[model samples]
Target: MGEEMPLSRIAAAVGTPVYVYSQAALVERAAAYVQAAQQTAARCLVCFAVKANGNPALLRLLGEQGLGADLTSGGELFLAQFAGIPPHRLLFSGVGKTSAEIQQALQAGIRALHVESWAEMERIAGIAQTLQMAAPVAVRLNPDVAADTHPAIHTGGRQHKFGVNAQAARQMLLAAADHPWLSPVGLAAHIGSQIRELAPFRQATAALLRLAADLEAVGCRLQYLDVGGGLGLDSISQAAPRPAEWVAAVGEPVAQAGYELVLEPGRSLVGDAGILLTRVEYVKEEGGKWFVVVDAGMNDFLRPALYGGEHPIWPVALRSGRQRESRADHTWRVEVVGPVCESGDTLARDYELPPVAAGDLLAVMQAGAYGYAMSSNYNGRLRPPEVLISGAAYQIIRQRQTMTHLLG
Candidate 1:
């Protein structure tokens, strides 16, 4: 089946403003990386970024297939563990890790913690000392390689409050030997998200390799090189490199160094696997523009309003021949907006779409990664349900948020 089971059938059964995920697509996308890594000479660990889509059922499904979880907070760690990811299989990465969170991770024996600041490194060391445990740590390098993406998401630049600069990282690595509680085992850097080119990745890889070489020269033997994940998928019409291409680009250099490679992929593995199903509530024409108001607002799907993100939208029933609508050549340039009061709640502006009515269902494509994961109850609107579809069958992994739950 193609994208599978059709969004029309899903909307009919589950209602609008819902999220539908394809189980086959998710597994296939994840397995592509595993396959690519296996083909590489480098020993690799595939850690699914839990922040991307931390649905318990989804995480549990991925964990059952041997994918480890890459977490940013203690809550993500709990979700990953609840989903069956063992402590040893988790990689904790975040800028501000509380002492309590550090203690929790140390007690759980997580694989490695990507230490961002020297202060954070010290904090972890102190916590580990208190617990009488030696914590595995990796100093994240800033790299300063600017990826060609939205500036808000860029993480590796000097001004960004992400990893430490090269000099600071070098100092941290050298100082790690003095702290008996901290075992410096790796170096990590994440450039940004929604990146489409390979140059930035290659540049980041080379930078990390140089730092790794320098650290080794200074008597710091690193075990793994984590070239953090920002590998982009085709969100708009831009073509993205396949998982194999990405794996080859990043894995070859580290493979040559014989260091265990770790990739924390969030979007590329899940973005295209899901769709946001919404219903057109009204179609208005004013000021020489058509506005197609939808039931799902910024509270339900915020990517379009936040990142200026573009996702493909299609009529569900029209494509499936279930509704009496003509697939005419005529189209309307309409603004696909949500029912939120904020003017910024618009999903797409001046976009062309087939004529839609109040009852028509629209499927917002490439929504699996950040759609539901970033949803909220803003404006007191209840969050929609999530259905995982496998072939022709579908199961509601999450129920639509009820008014009772929202009120209470």
Candidate 2:
């Protein structure tokens, strides 16, 4: 595979600032997920959350692995469909879903809509009724569980605007009883993202099981229980917990409670399986510190700026004579940044990178998930192209964002 078409060759052709994903790695993650949950539950469905990386190719591969989709917006729903995801395998979820979005989901007859609040449920019920269709829905419960990660991704807090509070979920379910246009398919909740510990997920699933019991006691035939995915992969490995563990922690709980399981995993699936390739533009020294400015910025990958995310940075080439075989001694720590002008626009605050001159290639590890999806045209800079690598070749999935493309 390395001899056929190494990543360095693709970066050389496309020019630096290219993102690529490995299909083999992604499939490995999917298989692990299936192996984990399939043991206890036959009615389980692993739904890949679309908001993390909306790339169609990635979705198609995940879908091919028998994974469904968890969508938050009309665009994501449309993207899911465009990627060949059947409406029956797609679940729409989000707070602040506009009536227009609800109408779209209703028309598609999606698998389920995880309604966030009582108000949204009433609206969905009305929309479904108007369309003369029964909207299969689930009430997202904010169990107030924390993922022990960054606060930005936290969604299960009572004060958070993500899901329906526990006290109100019961009442809302009762109110929803009369709305024949909607069916209580199950319950859903997302704790947060980039979580390292499994305890939070275990704890969160316990609460969801309890809520399912409460609903069942009230004569609600809850069919599904979605314990939202917040699984964290190693920052360096970009790989996460084994699928079996997640299934054991989540899928088993729903199975024990006699309900179907839906897992909406995002970053853990693609984050580590891909990386960003950029080129060094220039080098600068300030205040006795070295800086390696590259062509990539927060616009290309926002995780660093948004969550202080870290990605291993390495140079494409190393100087000769550094070593007889490997340029192991050429590596040095520097602040790898971009030309975005903001000090916060830096990509790696401090990184041990190979000695690189202008135009040398650098690979930013674990960047497949949120890398290009969160990119912007700030500083009038065009976003880079995206490539997908199989065994020994690369295909340009998305072209570099041209000035005309950005302007128009």
Candidate 3:
């Protein structure tokens, strides 16, 4: 807490239930990726996935570091422009892209579009062909690799909503060679997010490489192998490799294959650098269980409710620990919940919180990536502000959502 900004100051400026991201931390982290990729034989374009945390400040810092942009939406492309990332240094990826969105990417002159499905590849080709423009695209492959991640995040699985199957991709790549408007340039694979193990990445890369090899045999020129973002942060880095370590492990094949490697890193870059602060409002007991309520609800962070995700919750400011005479260790098992009226609104379940009282501060750690981006106006609670802190100084990047903003 001391190395970063003091939670006290951020709360004072933005009020509680706000998210604060450290710009310095984000910049330093981006530099690390650049350095690590340079160490390898691979010529890398480190593209920050704008789907993660698209705060203009974070994006601009990444651009200053010479990182590229990976966008999924038109707004994301616009954000990259605002962050000073030239369209040429950007790559766009998504499963469902409307015609307007594809046209926007084309006008932006993005580096490449990672086409996920056969239909998408055809759609992009048709759009580019009509405009008499040459489009460079990579075929996103569902390699059927079982990543060592939560089932819900496993995109390579047959049931997942992302990427074209290997068979379909092979057919698409060869067929794309005939399209004058679209250039078939590369292959892309993303197994899942928060993947901690090495074997799954090795498996995914090996499959993607093999698929690329087969396509090359058919006279397809493969210039880029995107290897889309899924690198994770260490909430438990004890088991998880740090950023550089993971990059080296996951990226070795790109060096061997002698292609330009594009990395779309989302959570690993921004997750640990931000925290969410909420103010405790009340405490109660029900069904022989202790409950501590806070102002930040599922509306503010849906990870817990949506994915049963693990977010380490802790006290922002330490208070003296005392023993309660009733319990053996004087600790009570507790469920930390939010103020949302829905019974499903829970931040965490069946854990321990400090003896919480009204006005106490709770900090949800490692929240920078999906926290604000996924927040909603459920229960009519205003979305929290976002802050960036440097030493003792702090600035608000996003103001708290106001009630009137919803009305409008």
For model 2, residues 183-295, the per-residue Cα lDDT tens digits are: 77878888888887788788888888888788778887787888988887676535556656777877776897788888888888878778898888887778977788888
Worst lDDT 10-window in candidate 2: 319-328
Better model by lDDT: candidate 1 vs candidate 2: 1
Q: Model 1, 25-58: lDDT tens per residue?
A: 8888878888888788547888999888999999
lDDT at 209, model 3: 82
Q: What RMSD, rounded to one decimal, does every model reach?
A: 2.3, 2.7, 2.1
On residues 1-408, what C-alpha lDDT tens digit does candidate 3 reach at each position? Answer: 335567876776678899877777787888888888777645888888888888898788789999998898999999999999988789988899888889889888889888888788888988998888988888888888787677777788778888988899888888878878888888888888887777777777788888888887877868877777787666433356777776777678777887777788888888888888988888788899888899899899887787776788888764456444545554567888998887778888887765766777888888988899888888778888888887768888888988897895
Q: In angstroms, give how far residue 371 of model 2 lies from its true place.
A: 1.4
* lDDT (0 to 1) per candidate: 0.87, 0.81, 0.82
Clashing pairs in 2: 36-244, 316-361
lDDT score at residue 235, model 2, on the 0-100 scale? 69
